[model samples]
Target: MKLVPLGDRVVLKQVEAEETTASGIVLPGQAQEKPQQAEVIAVGPGGIVNGKEVKMEVEVGNTVIYSKYAGTEVKMDGTDYIIVKQEDILAVIK
Candidate 1:
């Protein structure tokens, strides 16, 4: 199964959060923060949305940073993914 985003939406898979701190301290599940970084899996076709012509700047396989609370989570084939509006994506990693 695959996800195909529509209308300025993007599909992504979250990057794994660190289980240990830089100081070598191990963090438990509850102590780990939700990862804001994700890999673009699918991108929507850019078109007129909200009366504005939007062009998609990100492409598939690009790593991106998004708002911490952005997007809706989906589970498929035991894998997790998130669907967010393009605006919610803060930056694309080079």
Candidate 2:
């Protein structure tokens, strides 16, 4: 099954966290922090939202950084994804 966002929602697949520290010490899975970076999988068409006109600034294949506690988590066919509003996305990684 595939995810198709509606309104101003965006679908993202998070980039895996680093398993090793900069010093080369391998950290266990539990010690790794969830990365805020994610690749844009799908984007909702921009339109009127809450009395304001919204425009989508990101696109598929773009890497973005989102708020730490933003978005809803979903699992499909063993793949994890996050669905969030466009406003929840902080910045696009160039």
lDDT of 1 by residue, 28-88 (tens): 3323333377899999998998889999999999988876466899999999999998998
Model 1: which ten-residue window has the lowest total lDDT?
Answer: 24-33
Question: Candidates' lDDT values, in order?
Answer: 0.82, 0.82
- Estimate, for each residue in 1-94, the C-alpha lDDT of model 2 and write its tens digit: 7898988999999877565657432323333333377899999997998878999999999988776465899999999999999998888878
Each candidate structure's TM-score, on Cα atoms with residue i matched to residue i, is 0.79, 0.79
What stretches of model 1 exceed 4 Å from their correct place? 18-35
- In model 1, the Cα lDDT at residue 9 comes to 94
> What are the per-model numbers of colliding residue pairs?
0, 0
- C-alpha lDDT of candidate 2 relative to the true structure: 0.82
